[model samples]
Target: MLDLTTHWAGILSVIIFLSAYVLVVFEEVTHLRKSKPVMLAAGLIWMLIGIAYTVAGHGHETREFAAHIIEEYGELFLFLLVAITYVNTLEERRGFQVLRAKLVGLGLGYRGLFVLTGALAFVLSGILDNLTTALVMGTVILALGSESKRFVTLGCISVVVASNAGGAFTPFGDITTLMVWQKGKLEFLDFFAIFLPSLVNWLVPAGIMYFAVPQGRPTPQHERVRAKPGTLGVAVLFALTIVTAVSFKNFLHLPPALGMMLGLGYLQIWAYFLKRNGARRSDEDMVLDSFSQIQRVEWDTLLFFFGIIFAVGGLGVMGYLALASELLYADLGPTYANIIVGALSAVVDNIPLMFAVLTMDPDMSHGQWLLITLTCGVGGSMLSIGSAAGVALMGQAKDGYTFLSHLRWTWAIGLGYVAAVGTHLLVNAATF
Candidate 1:
């Protein structure tokens, strides 16, 4: 392997990534998409690597590494695209809105709604990504009691914490978990081992914040929203799609993306039936076009993933990640080092942090791998800016769940974080 630890290309690549990341962190203030700077940095860094390695007469090795990175990004991209497409289809069918309406109609007390939304986020995020889970449950909380600032604040915090925690226990839940799974570090069922710890992570903070919820039912929301035709079928297809993906990975020993793409066909066929039925109905109740939902996938986020992978892969090829692995994993050891990785994730995006860890390819046990997965998944909840769920909720409920509001509860969240780590150490000690 080529070592570019002291190479000028390595130094310049570091500068480019850090500068782009600064823009990413300040994206709200700058009114710029997080994808733009990183995309540009990925291109520039890779271009430099191509040139440097080619001149050094290691063009073949460089090409092989670049191809490997491309393959990695491709699998993740297709899988997420399919997942987002399913989510968009559900949204179009009023699946989420109907749930929100039902919750609001229940007229649960502030505390009840808080626990319910948090719990739903915790469970739903295991199937859907944390961002979607947070958004859905956050909307429910807003509708359930938008007038109560106290309720909204507490509810938003809980949703963020729960969504991140829930995503930790399932491969489909968060980008970090998916990376670990796709890397073949753990089997599909192995992720469930952390479910208890993930639950404790959310429950601790929720129990502490429960008392602070305002008392009384939210203002009555009497709106009668209904699901579109084929809602149930679409949901079933989504479930089947997930099963197919897992089966492909676990049974067929194939790339999960292949199953996800194949599942896209199931949705298309279902959409055809809906369109044909809607044409016969005067009210156009079943008139969804699945292609439109495909267009609604979060392209910016997908692009951001592409850029981060390549950029980090470039650094890995330059030998920076190896140095990091030796310093963090080798010197501090996996337990402390993994804890620090999780803490750092509270400030940085967990995607890149996990990607860097994967790139480093440190030698660790199955329990240590699970430890990193749990930490990266939930660590982002310590601050509103730490996770996509928190950031989206901040935008969705601007006046209620501001950065300071979340920061105020950081101590409680931090306590939950520690408890989660301790619980895993105690309960999963046999695995270690």
Candidate 2:
């Protein structure tokens, strides 16, 4: 590792990664696909590393490193495949619509509705995913707001904060947290330990923005749709999937992905039953077939994740992460360094940041690991481009939810970020 920095490949790796990441962050504005550059860089970085090691008379090291990368990331890629496919299965069947109707039908006043909506985003993102939670909640807000710009704008910001915050306490919440979970740095129930601070992260922003919600009843939406068969079943099975994954990892010492993939099989069986049943079904039900649901999975996101793992793995092989850990954690201290990294996640991509940190293999207590996880997971709410939930909302609520629009409320969100970090430190004092 000593000569890694002196080698030309190390410098080339850094330049390629930086250039690729710049385009990835500004991908929306540039109309350049984020996956393309990252995928290209992933290959190039590995190629450079392989070349360097071979030339240095350590060709065997290249094979070992490549295998390890594939083993770790392949598990993660499959884990997300099942999770994302489950979400798509629900969405394609309008399960989210049913959930949305339940919230909307509560008949609360505008202020009350806004509060509940934010609360729902928090809880729902933990189960259904941050991006989908934002989409469902965003649609509800826009419909409830009845074209009121203030309500739509304010609600969008709250949803983004709540979504990011809620995602921190669950394994399947955000990509960063998921990476940590899959990396074996944290266990399943360990995530729930941070639920309190995650709640605070959401509530602070929601409380601050509560005043902006308009008064009186929303313009009632037209007829709400009924929940379809298998919708409730899907929800129940997802819960079972969580339980199975946890039990397998904690007791049987099996990879949690085994449970997740099994759950997908259950969904596929149910879809097969639907296919054979002698009954008419809507187009939504038709998509319940495994083939259609699989087709709907977010391949771009999965590919982006693949590239990040490989690219960062290459840097790890070059000992770049060792340099980062020494400078940021050893020199500056883990606490402040982690907080700063978490804050940077608002502007940069958290996936690579977390991956890099894991590669560094910092010598921190579980408390410290949990702390960084909470900060990185929730910090994405500081700006619209800070998170997938925020980015998706920007696309869906195109007119009102711009990055600048989110910036206007960053003070409130930033306050929540600080408060959440403080709460984590206080509550998890034992671990530190």
Candidate 3:
């Protein structure tokens, strides 16, 4: 409605978005919640856009913009909602705990255990969020290797790298990949294109770190945890949910969230009967207490995304993204531009970067899209603070796996990143 392409509105949008991001990055020092600033930025950016529309006698355009955000972003929100909910349901059922217990019981020697842990993190991170995967596996490594601090430290590093690398190959593996998938830039099947590269991304550094793990076997102090009544059923249902989500997207011409929410319904029904016949009646049961699980849906994360996505959307409408597109892709060429984007992801958060790229809406081959996804996903491991996996591991194993400890291995991880990109260029050359 209004030509705010060159209007002050565009400049204002960038300022608000960046300011909010700075607060988020330093949230620890500030002792303030990152979501607070970003959420405010979203509201302010939208208000600025409304004022711009009013100035040009196009105030009605504000509603259309809001509708567009709701329709597009809402789909992503719902899809994540179902996935997160299913994961939380598993958490309630102690599926992760059970899996952790079984892993520890493998009676693996130190090097064998190291490989097992890294491999599990890689595969699980492809299905679970990388942060969660790293946290869980990092715990196992620290626990079993507690007598040997050096082994624990190196193992923590492997977990972070493996989690980040594993996340690069799947749609649900990392938030950046999810954004790429939700944007329709890459299809469900398109992710398989990078599977080998992602595997190399994990295995290369893992191979390097293998010698670091001592040759002794693990003496795990096993916990006395019992599986919940319906744990297996819920896990089966969770797997079904994932399959349904993929089916909906590939065959039904609908947002995968629709299929996932329906799967949630199946989980609910199973939960109901499990509760009806079971002896334990704790409220954490997903079916017996459905609202309880819904309440645990990481609202802070979802809200943080709400603000970030809306703010990024405002910038897209304001035209700064086009300027970026011209400078990065048009002038620099797609290959170099994408490679640089991946590099920046190490220092800067890739959430806003990927969202901005999605908003910029550049046109490129499918191969180029997968390349950026791999880069952004793996690049985050270059610094311990660069990714959720690294940051979470730092917190979980602070005694030895500090920021400096992780940084000590940056070169190796960085090499893995380069190899992954190279592999993509060679193996998926046709897509590019």
Candidate 4:
């Protein structure tokens, strides 16, 4: 007899996952619906479904799965909230404005501007995150966009590519990479093994864009803005936020949420002091305003993530993930599987995919695991909507970074992706 009950549960989970993803993508491509409400709705729906399944079937395992997700991913949620809040607050303090003025003040021609912006975006993405780096750099491109739309478009694309490339080299640079790291699926230094290839990924696309840029005369420098009075304090707090976040994650062995909670408290205190003193109330208002700016944050993206996580977890619980892993190993072997996984990341969010792979726990060499890391990290740049960096930039530079504009650069990004994956293969082969 057919196992109708098991099959139905699996089908329901898949439907929920696909529906959530479709809704999010629809919102992104068409702007027909609001993302936050959709995501919240998806989360609630999945939570109910998951509960139903637990009651009807494996209650113990389902409860354990929910608990594990809370314990492991809870910190990540806190990290996201704290990190976004901090950046929003700092940007309101004119931190981004100051950076923008400086970039414009360089008075570089199209070529120089492209190079400087690309390089800055890459480096900044490594330290902060590709999403923030892309947004900040996109702002600069928008500010100087009056020079040439082509130049602005090329510059924005280059920054997006560079940000993703640079982010691939560090754990903190991209969320997918961080998830892999947290799972102990890949080590910290193991990432550096693929660093050279990641550089190639950025440079190859940048080089093409360089040739395409028009040979125009340098523009006059824009007037620079003076740093806000509390700019230094903001910067210091930002640095401390990162340090404290890492310490909590690494030293204290606490979830990142704990660290973020503490850091937020510290930031609040600092803001309070600034308010009490003679600091301009306008500055305080700006900071608070930035919090509202977060309303612009993609609610759909986060919701899609939650739905996928639950759906995938459901699949794994049902042994589908295990069967898939076994089939891959038996049919294609590990290298090709890694490539396929990487390519799939361009379409699906890499977080759930990486987690799915981790659950499968394939028997592979360390080098092969590193290859997975490298491929997954860089492969996301294949499309505009593939990575957080791309999405954030699109939102930040909507005028210039439309879907079609990104499509124009897709071929270049593909070359970089290929180069990165190829480099990883070579390094893995050599090391093994």
Candidate 5:
């Protein structure tokens, strides 16, 4: 392959990526879907890579790189597809709506809801990915329809932080942790070592931000919403799916995506049974069809994942990430390097950043591996544009949560970031 360090193809690809990312960062103002520019950039960058490699008489190498990148993307794509489909299936069955009704009926004050939502986000993200956790909690926060923008703003920020911190300690929580786990850098149970630290990461900011939340409950809307038949079964199936995914990775030695797809089949079969029984009796319940549920997923967000993977993969193929790894890990050392990576994750997607680190396959202890996992997983909480959860919430909450709104509380999040790191060092010192 051609040397991309100073090559025209590399230079232009970097420019294209940065330009597209700028548009993505200002998506609220531009009214542009975050996926569009990155998709275009991914294609453009690959085209440049293809051309450069062909000119250098290494065209086949470009094909290999594309194949590898596609495989990586495909695994994540399928895993997320099943996860989103299940979430959608639950929503279609009025699962979230019923839950929302229950929470709203509580008539919790703003401060109470703030803690509740954040706490829920943290716990749920351990089972679901951070993005889904944030969206679920975000729905509840938005449902309040509270005229208080400050409440919405604080609630959204709290959820974002909680989701990221919560996901940091679980293999299935964040893509970064999943990548680390999949790479055999850490074991499944080993992730729990950082659980306390992750909790600290969330609680620090939450405790500090608690005072800012306004008092008084929003007017509770009491809708006697009930989940349809099989809702409980679906939840059970989802739990089984999580088990299947873990079993696939740990025991079967198969890709977790396959297990997720099999879990999707569990939903499909149940859906068929539900349809056979004609379970839906009211207008509130949507037909329980898994395929239709799949259709309801956030395609924009999925496509954004597609764009990010390809764009960053292209950059990795060009050698920038390896160079970065050497600079960060070799010169700066593992601890500081991991910390800086966390901060960078606030700027760049942790998926690609972790992917690059796994690809570089640096020598480090178990503690260091866990440290990077914790940092990358929660680092995105530092900025609104940092993680998928934050970005999705910004769009979901609209004017209530913006880049500037999230930026205003960066110091608190940064403190949480530092606290989490220190806790990890102290708690997991045995691993080192």
Candidate 6:
């Protein structure tokens, strides 16, 4: 029947989304398969299926889908490439090592390290993503070792919570926020409207963990490495790249990718010159190793994201999103709907959920949209697998962190989640 065909397309879109999520989870749990390739394959599969349905029934051109994918997501891909390149370059130069040495040198007791590391991860995540923040902090914790297992676990959980909470305030901090921004669903500074609430999300859990952490003796001071002679140059170059990228985004109306690409090129050139300019053997070696570290970048996450975008795009094309939006809005209403959506983000990827919401175009005031953004952004800390920080920490520090270990912190996260929502409602009520 004609009706059946329409419904089938919608069903296929959901199936594709679910399938990609399964692959992502499987990759995380098994570690037997690579996620990037699997994600790419899944994306292509859904794209093909979408094309088949569109062409067969709707008389849509296949090229239109491809064009849509490029036009809509091209900048995102570029931003990913550039961001990855920058992260890889800094990681290669031991950017994080400097921080690690400082933390260890603080001679902080186990409790101090736990609190400090968690706070740092939370703050840093506002600038970088939660995953990178977690990776850097988690690595530091791992370096600290089992002598501080309790502290390390507490620190990791705090970092996960803080990172997710902090990420909600910025456009670049989380994928869901970024997707929503890209779709013109929200503005950049508008996110800060809920900043107080977002901060509360981390503070609540962090405060709890602060008390939960056991006191221990201070760690012995570790030897500090002198900054390489050209460290300043590398740092400057890095700053310039970021500045240029931001300039492109704000002033030029260019895609975020343009800045990232320019930055990547600059780093490569800077590294080449540094290598050629009689740089010390140690500095040169560090730079070389840093370059190599790019290989370790999680390509799987990127591919998985790509697949999800396409699958969701397919759903958008099918008109199912509109109907689903109507049903959800009617049944849940915006206030409870926002909470339910945020909670669901713990199990499902918030990126697609954000996309689905964008498709829905709920008629809401700016404050309400801000609430949605804040809740979804901070809500990811609810579970270890809920956000990038959790997943990345799990993968990079598998020896120490497990899903169950993260689950132990759920009560703390839940408290934070509730506090964040409550704070947002209070702030909104007072303001409006």
lDDT per residue (tens digit) for residues 189-293 in model 1:
999999999999999999999999988877777778989999999899999999999999999999999999999999999999889888977548798799999
Candidate 3 regions with alpha-carbon error over 4 angstroms: 1-6, 279-288
Best by TM-score: 1
Top-lDDT structure, candidate number: 1
Which portions of model 1 show Cα errors greater than 4 Å?
A: none
As a whole number from 0 to 100, the lDDT of residue 332 in candidate 2 is 91
Count of backbone clashes, every candidate in sequence? 0, 0, 0, 0, 0, 2
Ranking by TM-score: 1, 2, 3, 5, 6, 4
Q: Candidate 4, which segments miss by more than 4 Å at Cα?
A: 1-6, 29-57, 279-304, 395-399, 428-432
> Which 10-residue window in model 4 sums to the lowest lDDT?
1-10
Residue 227 local lDDT, model 2: 60
TM-score for each predicted model, relative to the true structure: 0.98, 0.96, 0.94, 0.86, 0.92, 0.87
Tens-digit lDDT track for model 6 on 248-364? 767887765687778877777776776766455554453443355456666766766676666666665556666667677777788888888899989987887876787667886
Cand. 1 Cα-lDDT: 0.93
lDDT of each: 0.93, 0.85, 0.82, 0.72, 0.88, 0.72
lDDT comparison, 1 vs 3, better candidate: 1
Candidate 5 structure quality by residue, lDDT tens digits, 22-88 = 9987887899998999999999999999998888888888888899878878888898899888888
Give a tens-digit lDDT track for model 2, residues 4-84: 776899899889999999999888779988888999999999898888888878877788888988988887887888888
Clashing pairs in 4: none
Question: How do the residues 1-432 of candidate 3 rate in per-residue lDDT, one tens digit apiece?
Answer: 444667888777778888998998888789777779999999999999988888878888689878887777788788888888777877787778887787777777778878888888889998888988898898788768877788888888888888988898899999899889877889987898899998888778788888877888768566756676677887788789888988988888778889889988987888678777653554443334555678899777788888888888887777667878999999998888888888888788788788877777788888999988988888888888888788778878877788888788888887888888899999999887
Residue 49 local lDDT, model 5: 94
| TM-score of candidate 6 to 2 decimals | 0.87
- Candidate 5 root-mean-square deviation in Å: 2.4
Q: List pairs with backbone clashes in candidate 1.
A: none
